[model samples]
Target: VQGSFKADIKLEDFVNNSAAVVQTINTWVEDRTNNLIQNLLSQNDVTRDTRLIIINCIYFKGTWRKQFEERSTNENADFHEASGNVSKVKLMFTKEKYLYGENKDLRVQIAHLPYKSDNTHVQFVFTVILPEKGVSLDSVEQKLSSKPQLLQQILNDGYTRTEELLLYLPKFKMEASFELSDVLKKLGMVNAFSDSAADFTGIVSKKDDPAGLYVSKVIHKAFIDVNEKGSEAAATTAIRLTKRRRLASDIKLVEFKVDRPFIFMIRESHNNITFFSGKFLSVPLSYYKRALRKIDVIFLDELGSEAAAATAVIMATKSISFRPKPSPIEFKADRPFLFYIRETRQNLTLFTGKFLTPTNFS
Candidate 1:
């Protein structure tokens, strides 16, 4: 989704004021999304001096331009990926000159539309699958013979056609966040965020001798819903910056596979960067459905017995790990704590419920 806008503001000045940052974000969203989306959170929440700022938002609105008509959509269309499994998906067939592009190897069409406002932008990328089935990702590199040409074609080529058919797609929503550090680091952008990263010297006036500080956290959320009626989705990204002259370190992606039921905590020491992580429990899904989920406590007394077990386990685990020794001894049997829990086809009360006193359980 995207909208149209024209303005130029200094990045440093925008970073200093929370309101400015939010307004800029809103503008970016509107422009990028082509006005298909809107900013829900007020601008004051995101500020320069603030160590951590939360950007909570949702996009329940519909699309400004419907690319695929209901009559031309094909229901039960098989979306066969590189894998052997075939997923029944709605086939939106359009010969329209979307942001169309192609080369000797690949044909990628990008559909640009408004998101309702100017805070973010999204492009619908339609890539033609060269290989019919059994996709080999390793071979994909060889397939894109001319990426530049393909990009150019998508930007300036193609035709438009509409028809009558059925389209059926499952609704989906995802909430996620990224530490700006990780994003920058991924882009080979460590130099701009390091201790000696002189590029940021202009962020403040002289005389304010800065010490050790780096980006502390990132938070994000995305939602998508589709049913017999239609489909709508949106995502929000937030960054938390800390003031310190810190060095960029190697990113160690610890793969905590939640194959079995286990409890973990997110605190200052564990380096747990994610929050509110979770998995979906389809009928066949076991603990193996997803890798890990970040947990937080809510409604302790009313959480019943399950919440108590998760709390105890998290308390016991956090106390022994980080620097200065977090005092898990303070964790009471009644109060709730935070920890990831694995669900199953059967009952998943692996380590919870015993802590509740006898004859007093709810």
Candidate 2:
């Protein structure tokens, strides 16, 4: 609680000046999140019955160790969805050395991309878990849910090797908001949400006054942007006590193309803590079918047979010689996938999301 701050707002003022109070809270959220999130709470969110409001915000900005070249990003790359739909997306490409692993048992390919950190003791990484082409992301999620240790194994035991790879990842931005009272209730924390059963003697002494306290609503909002440079993410959570609610590789390397839907996470390398995790399912209404470029073929109809034959021979001789290069192993994630952001030393997940679609495209 060293960095924690507390403030008291009169209930009368909160109810009378609801808009101002909401603006004050939103201003704090915007400041904490570098303006990435705004209007976190509205008039309907706060009420006179609300005894207390607690909020937490986290913001992160990290640059890639070896960034993707802006010019190398393909503006119209094809992303294949799980439903067999295709969308045009901004795809990033790079060939560099990176920590990588493959788990046959899990049927997944893992790649670790480290971020540049000023603190030597702190190392942040973006990890992508791409299921084998035929494997469904749901299956992988089910397996990880069933045996959480498998995720640890995937992070610790599986990624010991480094390889050069051709990587393709999409540039995406996502903003998500969730009302988590029901989710928390389902997790078996019912008493806190129950007005009759909730005990708030610790927060509000019964001797002082006894309407008691229960969580009314729990809302969480998050935002993230991943591009050629690195990533910027912000998240905020507000708990109203009025209710018992909660609220890249190089030459000859393997190819790791995230052209499909997959799983991704950002973590601190030292403590193996996951900060954010989510799946990129699909790119909303941003689907585009690239129009085939029309090529005009001119025939030498006016040329004599002998002349045409001679021209054909000359053209054949002058044709550019194409050599077949060795194809690196391709790890294209053309479908949906997941991503996470975390702090290393404390082993805390900062952000988790899925980039199903591109929010911005040129």
Candidate 3:
């Protein structure tokens, strides 16, 4: 079961010592989260003007039904980025029977992994929804939100059957912080943040004073660490007068490699109510190294200074088809080769080199 804590504190007592208030609140958060969250609020965030601070935190720790083998994890696995850049990542590997399926209409892949349970009746499944290589997460979310039934189908038993699954999930740790004032305003809760228009008489003693209290800022922080065993995640939301608030694929063996951007959800298997959902984007830097190419150009610098130096030089050229063609013949360069730069019209060689290796060239 997930544990959550909620509390409200007055800022008047610690008006002069904001640091102490921050430290106290952070300590409470750390204690509630098993020290997973150290500093939920900073000294700079708490001030004399901050009258009421409302805080909420949720912590979850669970073990996987089938734990991955630590030795099978590859430290350097290719993770494809949306920008077409491939980077290395610590990819956890496992081959076991898992609830898996694919949707041709949505062009998405789905996989379900249940958390360990002693009762054997209550099941909490973590489902991953991955769009095709070119498909975006935004599109998937939009489609799901518009047509809620589609989501039910994706999670239903008919869509996913037991299969021998080859899974490659990256070991990742992510911490995210956000200011949600603007988001709430955009969501049509405009009056909540406006100092003049807001009406929160029930919350604080602002009887007829329209300018008395209005949400100034809403801050939120979340963290998740996933590894061989399972996951530990914590999230905290605070409102300072503020209030406002807050892949795949497949084949025969059913290979499911989450080496790219995808969406995930933790749901109660019985009712299918999603408790937590998020998108995983951008792999760790250590996961993949970028393919780099270097170009070295040798230009005739003296040609500009000396007007008479090879003024009308011509270069020999070979034209190849820029469009479709059959398989081209392969030219292997295992042995030494000759390279020449010559003035085509004058039939005079300007430079010649014999290449045996990169370091040994003449």
Candidate 4:
């Protein structure tokens, strides 16, 4: 059985070190990763303890508003980096009001869209450098560094409100978990995680006793989605610990420049339904649609599932077979048939009556 969720501290040193205590923890957890999870658990805290150890973990997910169909991504595309190297990357494209710019001299159009905010708060910006008749990204970043706003000037004046844009991005998602004890030690605060280290006066100090300020578990999870129209990223980082007491503080910002292909997903926390799904597999739409039709909607993975459907009906989850041999008309067009869809965690009502009357399905 899953236990109740709570943040309990010894409460003795909770007042003094509250400020630094929270800041240190935030830095420790946030510095571990540079991804999209930060956007999810932006304003969060991890509590410490003496006897009971609290472990907090979160799952973050997201997807693009306007999907870049799988087949749109093709090979023979150039991906330029800050190091003056161009890799062969599969570019995904779409025509929309995207963040775009064109460097006439370099002959490239770069569109940048920040990814969704998650726990680790990472922004995935992509620049599609459409090289001119003979230009390439190889000389672009270098020229920008020398001239500074060469790219900026283009971005400022080159931003056009075009509805249809040829967009190309690789879909991807990253999952990582790290235990940050030694990492914290490297960040300059050493006494906090030791047995003989003195003075936790800021957080809970019991008569000069050094039994406080030992971090047990620092778990951070992140997720991000970026495609056509804008991007979304989110995450939840929990510091489940013991021998401690501290108050939480402000959050920091981190950016992840995504210039390659990656996979991503959008998961519903409350209902666990994946409303919109995107893959960077470069497969046909019909393949995914047909596969999706056979898979259970409630719990779908990259593979498949034998998930069970709901039984009790009180809303829109009804089947022609679920009725009966001339079932009683407890719910007519005046009332309506009510069934439940476990996947979306919603109570849907199928009705054919007055809007006013259909709403009173108590």
Candidate 5:
């Protein structure tokens, strides 16, 4: 049976000597997974602010019952992209009897690639689902959403007979890391990420300390490689959960060329639960670049009304001088310019002047 594991460490200790701790954890993880993963946590990831750190690692190495011949692999196959572009990819070719089926309703072709089974009844299989041309994996996924049993039905009993199938699958490698805090929150996991709203008192019990711990980050990393020999896969998930309440059947020799966007999964045969599933849109998961952009936007508009425009400019000013301090005054001029000197308290006009262009001054 699987069980949960937890560990408690002082952030101060790590903060004092973060290099040692980071190196220790990274080395431990690397050795645990046979060096498939390195640098599990960076120096910045384990900082003084981090209250607690939790890590989970899983590793697997399996051999295919029938491996693809290296010499037969083709490097000139065109992989059709959803964007109507085509790229050349190395397709591993194999001719073997695979469990396969075609769902007329779903409009998809399913094939099963079984790994070498051990003494136990449980086995591991890589299932590939390929949609027909002019169709999309998204549509097939939508159909699966409605009919969740489609995968199992197709895998378990959909294929009646095993026949010689010519399979062409791309040889690729994938490594992905996801920050799932916001994604979890959007799925109704609110309190776990909320510092004030979370309740993980059971995780740590110290009445004197009232930091109100909550989960700050949940990081997941995965790696998978498929070659002529077999598949080597490993993944590590670090909760950093903090004291806070952390949170196919192949019928005939029908050609199933995976020269396009398709989905695949590494699942156990017993329960048919997916251990790792992903869409292979292209090769080298890091083929796409990461970008950060900063943009500045300034709004422009015409005031339209002279009174409003003048009022806006006056209100926006930092300084304004008034003669009597509290007295109210009104002055409106449409044409050029005008000024008047008067005895304000006695209401007597002493002088008046009007000026237009520079010609008037000249």
Candidate 6:
């Protein structure tokens, strides 16, 4: 029941002082996320019609139980891209005992790296899911999407043993932002976003207004940084009420080199709550150089009414765009992979994303 709610701003301000409103909301977002997430809202995202907004923000920073040696990191390590290209990246190396497992069914090597936590009830672990070399990550994604329980099964049954491992994980930083109204609609959540069908009478008394209220937009932004010391991540989600709409393991010196694309997640050990989950499909710009050589742009315009003569104009332009080995116990992630953070007790996912190419390298 504990929460933070703000209702002082008037709907008129959303129209007349949108900039100020946006700044207020964004500032709150930035502060809550330790400045890791900023500008969660723009003026265009708010209007006079907007009646309410709900926001949630989370920030996490964890040190590895056994930190990587700063000097052991390789700055020029070659990371294999899914596109068959290679890029030089900063990869951190460590030798440590970690929880590890392999799911032959999923064709992935799993590694579990625990974070330093003083509270026993709040344990967190970072998990990496690396698909076997030459396996398409898309296929794995489809299976996971089709069967959500498969992920839980992987975490519970796949990683059953502890092993001493030589780990090579990339030093990376990434940020992502998404607008989810359409996505929600496509997921069968339609009534809340329909201007005419939305029902928010419980949230607001709409007896006097025929238009009532509906969701207009949902915005989400996230950031994460992984380095020798540990991991830092933050995410913010805002729901605008304006409209109705809306690791592996290994043991035995078994090599688990993650030199290709894979999936990952962070979660709480006890509850299996995943905080973050994403895939990293690292593709170097050079991989797309050939495609970038040619560029095409197409524009179409329709003129005239239904009863009148129809005229169409078409314009075209062209634009173009575009591992490792190891010991049996080694788990080197030199390619794209997915990762996430989660709370063990509550089984809540905190932050997750793919480690494609390192932002700096890209």
Two-way TM-score contest, 1 vs 3, winner: 3
| Clash number by candidate, in order | 60, 61, 6, 57, 8, 63
Candidate 5 TM-score to native = 0.68
Which residue ranges in model 1 land beyond 4 Å of their true spot? Answer: 1-77, 88-103, 107-149, 158-177, 196-199, 218-221, 224-231, 235-362
The weakest ten consecutive residues by lDDT in model 1 span 310-319
Query: In order, what lDDT does every prediction score?
Result: 0.24, 0.60, 0.49, 0.29, 0.48, 0.61
Ranking by lDDT: 6, 2, 3, 5, 4, 1
Summarize candidate 6's per-residue lDDT along 1-362 as a digit string, tens digits. Answer: 13445423334355578788778776776676666666677667776676667666666666777777778878778888778878777777877778777666667677877777899888777778877777767777776777666777666623456666878777665555567788889999887777767777775565655457777777766666566666676612121111000022331355566566766566777787876666667743432232211111000001100000001111111110111232446888887777766666666665555656544433
Candidates 3 and 4 compared: the better one by lDDT is: 3
TM-score pick, better of 2 and 5: 2
Global CA lDDT computed for model 6: 0.61
Q: Among all windows of ten consecutive residues in candidate 3, which has the lowest summed lDDT?
A: 302-311
Model 2, 135-194: lDDT tens digits are 777887887777656677667623445556687888776555566788889989787777
Model 1 lDDT vs. the true structure? 0.24
Q: Mind giving the per-residue lDDT tens digits that candidate 5 earns over 38-65?
A: 5656666665545555665555454666
Off by over 4 Å in 6: 1-12, 208-210, 235-252, 283-328
Q: Mind giving the per-residue lDDT tens digits that candidate 4 earns over 156-175?
A: 31342222343344322212
- Misplaced by over 4 Å in model 2 are 1-12, 235-253, 286-329
**Distance (Å) between predicted and true CA of 104, model 6?**
0.7
lDDT tens string, model 1, 1-362?
01443333333343556676557555554444333333422444344434323233322322322343456444444433333343333333322222111122322111221112232222221111121122232232233332433322222213211111121111112222223456657868665345444343454333453442333334332322222222233311121111112123522221111111111111111121211112211111221232122111111111010111011000000001223311111111111111211111111211111001101011
* TM-scores of all predicted structures: 0.36, 0.79, 0.66, 0.34, 0.68, 0.78
